[model samples]
Target: MSEQSRGVTVTPQDDRYPGLVEGYNHRFTGRPEAVRLAATTQDVVDAVQDALDTGRRIAVRSGGHCFEDFTASPDIQVLIDLSPLAAVSYDERMAAFAVGGGTRLDHLYQELHDGWGVTVPAGTCFEVGVGGHICGGGYGHLSRRDGLVVDHLYAVEVVTVDDTGRARPVIATREPDDPHHDLWWAHTGGGGGNFGVVTRFWLRSAGPRPTAPEHALPRAPRRIRRADVVWSWDTLDEQSFTALLRAYTDWHEKNSAPDSPGRHIWSNLIVLHRSAGSFILNSVVDDDVPGAAELMAEQLAVLTGPGGAAPAHVEEQVVSWMDTWMPSYSWPSDPRGRYKNKAGYLRAGFTDHQLAAVHRHLTDPGYDNPMACLVLTGFGGQVNAVAPDATAVPQRDSILKASYSAGAWTAPEEDELHIAWVRRFYQDVYAETGGVPEPGDVNDGSYISYPDVDLADPVRNTSGTGWPVLYYKDNYPRLQRVKKRYDPRNVFRHALSVALPS
Candidate 1:
């Protein structure tokens, strides 16, 4: 295939190849023979078709924030970079906001709020790509109030290869009678890179769209309050530590009901590894609501507990909605470098045993990565309002979502140490469930966006459950069917991509 046919193809010898192949995680390097930096939907279709014709393994990248090396694997020979196709506009035909697959969260937020005074409940990281995030049921601070980003997704434009080995573009909408409705559901949460390449997403909530543009989607929050509270590691003994955790979880359990007033608040308790010095609880709440301050104060008191004093450090500030969200909300001091992440959901508070395991791992002195931490973020609320089978994302009853991450590796030799530390930590935490979070009493399932390839390994996933079953639950079978229909040739696939069902 010629470069003209594929839009813009950069060979390994090209100067742009280095930046084109680089993703958020610097640990793993992608060395595709050529990179197709797509500038339009037609460009993506051309690139995929050309790769298919040439018998080249293809990988797709948007904002390049995939936690795993799914987009950066050595097996890939052609990478279709969608970052240059960032565009957000109102689609009169669909009567919804259309966002290009490569649009970043920050750009999307600004365009939606400024142009339309509306927004989708999306990822916290400003630089995250919309394609993979929404496809994997993206959620963030506004999620508790407005629900998952996919909940607003009305339609998707995708390029796929059929049984004839022909690549074509199709638009799938949520309308019941739409012939491609199944395709739309698959993208809701089937996880990215399984069925096809998503070129654009049209977002509009289920109900009717009023005549006004602002009413098309959920209105942007008037104001937001940010609060931070920290407890020194020295101040937390095992007893206080466990109490603090229980307090945080207990509050979520009570307030996570679909209609709870506490739904206005979103927070994450960052239980930093001991090397970080202090563990902190950061929260954001809708400042326009009544009793917002009182609600935050109440939650803070519960977290501190009866015996424990106030947080050693506390700061609260009110900022414009755009200010809190537009700036980088990424947690790490150095997020652009090496990192590994695994994710899981909790239906209830962590058991005493689980809490102890977390304490043990966080306090382990032998693991010296300062940036290593286990983050438990508040979930549920409006998210649980939808039925489990309503969309492809099945974990509707989860109260909290937890992520295990380790980063900032100084050298390649240090990679094993960081990996071992995080793996051991996760395995011990879920030891009773055979290593990883198997769907059961304590663990609901895993989040697909986190995409941990380790879960597919027999050595790492002693969970007695396969990776797909853990991530998709009963939704896996349906997703497999969609995979068979949309990607019969299986052109868009990776190590953990959905298997073609027998």
Candidate 2:
């Protein structure tokens, strides 16, 4: 569309590409075909159009956190970077915040809180881009109380490809009469990079849903009383391992409900496999509720007071009365790393024998690290009550959310082990549970939030189920339709990303 973008930039091109990545924003060292720091929505559209015209393999990098190198791949020539376009604007009439796709959670948090005393429900890591985080049904500390991030999406502005092989970059808004409404629907929990480059999003997600108190989304308790549960690896036997896991499972089952939230209870941020020696479990309570610390103590007594001696490591912190949680509150000490994670949707609470299996895996001296912890996120509040056909992400309220074990090292040597451990652990756990997809898949659905290409990988997983059903469930078909209407040529294609029928 412009004479200036006729050929690639004359910048020095780094001839070789290895695992070339940087943690900070200014890390594009190699001279790419062209790296246009897009400053506006129109710039993004122009850059995409130019790439299409030249028939170049274009890569989009926002915070470059695709861990799998989705941003700058092994063979990408042109890169349309939205990193320079990070900006946040508040519009009073919409009562919404417009966020740049390249902006990270931390930036958004500061801008929103400092400027408006409001915050978006997002992952715990402050670094992940808001776009990808929301795309995968973004959830966080506020999840038990608030639904996924996309759950409150007001609209989006996307740069897409039309049927005639033309770049059609327009703001796809969520409206009853909008023709591209399907695009808006897909944007809701359809996973990022599958549709198009979302320049910005208008979010309508609000905290404190209006359900009855028992059903109201769990908010941050007035005050938060935090405590840790630590057990040394050398101190336990096989039976101890089994009992520990069983205790966790049993406690989760018996105390995982309406009462927990009313009492402002969240969960034990269990640091399982020790990277060093013994791991830790960071647990929390309603700091607002008087005697909240004592209450958590009582609960722990009921769960783990048996033959085990006092915890080998214990730490506690107590804070303010207001209740809230930040982004994906997680286990990884290093938020930025090449990593792959898989998830399972849970229905029934795991049984004792199953808990024993869990212990075996967790206590495996080999599985020493916080990454090895099975993150058990609670999922029973308003999450389960959504109407099935309402949005694409269809895991409407279940009992608990299960994230498979292992956070591997960043070094290439440890990469294989980390991924292998996660995959094998998930496989074995599912084997004990029945099969991959777990017999009673929550509402016959899974979440798109935790993306696992394994579902589509015939070698590793033989679930026969495609990525759509695993994440979108019945909503997959609609997403395909949205993909068709918005990006007919399948321009925004990525591994584990959704594609429309040819």
Candidate 3:
């Protein structure tokens, strides 16, 4: 390791290189020429400037939770590791919380709630880094009730290169009088690596500005009620499976209104491949709300209504928000298996054909991966209350978010098998539109957070709607302008980065 401008730089043969290059998904291997562990904003500035002057391809790694290899690409020569810049502090000048881009969701949640009794609606995965998650318009359990995490974003401090190729740090806020307002708007949902390196994110409530930190963001829930209802795959016949999906989709379509009671509840239906033994519906509701138990019961009834068979087991619990706020939040297993994932947004329920395709692929005995599954989580409600162009995130009218994923052996030899399995599964399900989920009645494009590079591949994405339209819709043009302005040199870019203006 060598000290460089207040940060540490290491080569592939260095002792820290192995740990620094390892990301959440073990499938990809990154062997950048140098890795810079930035301890502060200045360190990042210096590292970036050095890379720029030296003509090296730059990449950044925050939480390393990206499903794709944006940060782990082979073209990368310099990797800026922002994990050391993790800090959560109150900004008296802004009257809001200033969270370092490197801060993980778990630490940010704990500090914000414990220090000020406030929280930003964000992703469920605790290990996710704020750098990418917020920029991609992150949503989770509290989203339906409070809106998106970016909705609370007030400002961002980022490092950028000027027209003369001079690296500098700039802050952009939502204030009307702020000259960098466009820069701030771009970060709302423009996705990371397209503009610049975000060092800090200022979070506050969407409404009236508060003079104090305690009153800045929405108050954290007092307690949360959670339940896990499981159904054995062996006993779940096609009739029951079809019924279960219908009940789930029907309920979402009926209760997606901004004022619907379902807004207080959020759930994910994990339809794992048959090898998993059972499918589970894990849900959570605000325990402090009136009739909370009844709401959960209502959802359970719908879930089991189709099967008519009793759940193999039901586990229910109520705990303070702080106790189980970050459920299932854990570090990734070392030497994990190779993985591939795809995502789609739905404005309504799944079509009968789509449902049948799901059953057919999941029940197929040809390919095997117990960890493979299609997880559908209820969306909309408060999310749809915002206008389509309120921020860079335009998928405001969606009712559900579907994720198609598979995890298989880490051995290089098995990579093709798992990748093929997930690709074929997703393609067959969306055969009506194309290999990809085109924006339409059944699918409303894809989520940038769960990005799939295949969407940009012509052979893979037969969906007539190009990749940019699927993710940004009409917002793509605006994002391009921001890209041209902030990243003129395209110093920070990857496979799916926002494109520059033609």
* Candidate 1 segments whose C-alpha is farther than 4 A from its true place: 1-6, 307-309, 324-328, 331-336
- Cα-lDDT of candidate 1: 0.86
Candidate 1 lDDT over 9-109, as tens digits, reads 89989877887788888887799999888878888888888888889999998788888788889999999888777889998878899898888888999
Between the candidate structures 1 and 2, which one is better when assessed by TM-score? Answer: 1
- Of candidate 1, the 10-residue stretch with the lowest lDDT total is 325-334
lDDT of 2 by residue, 1-502 (tens): 1344322232334322222334321222333566665667787778888888888776666665553445555466666666655788775545567788888877876676655555555666776777777777777655554566777777788888787767756766566688877788787788778888888887765453323222211233344676667778678766775666556545655554544542245564454674456765656655656666776776667545783334687667776423233332432335344566677776665655455556667666675456566777655555554665677767764566777745545565666677777787776666643345643533244565465667666666566666567677778777877787777777777666677765
TM-score for predicted model 3 compared with the true structure: 0.96
lDDT of 2 at 380: 52
Clashing pairs in 1: none
Off by over 4 Å in 3: 1-6, 306-309, 329-334
Show how many residue pairs clash in every candidate, following the order shown: 0, 23, 0
* Model 1 per-residue lDDT at 337: 81
Per-residue lDDT, model 3, residue 182, is 84
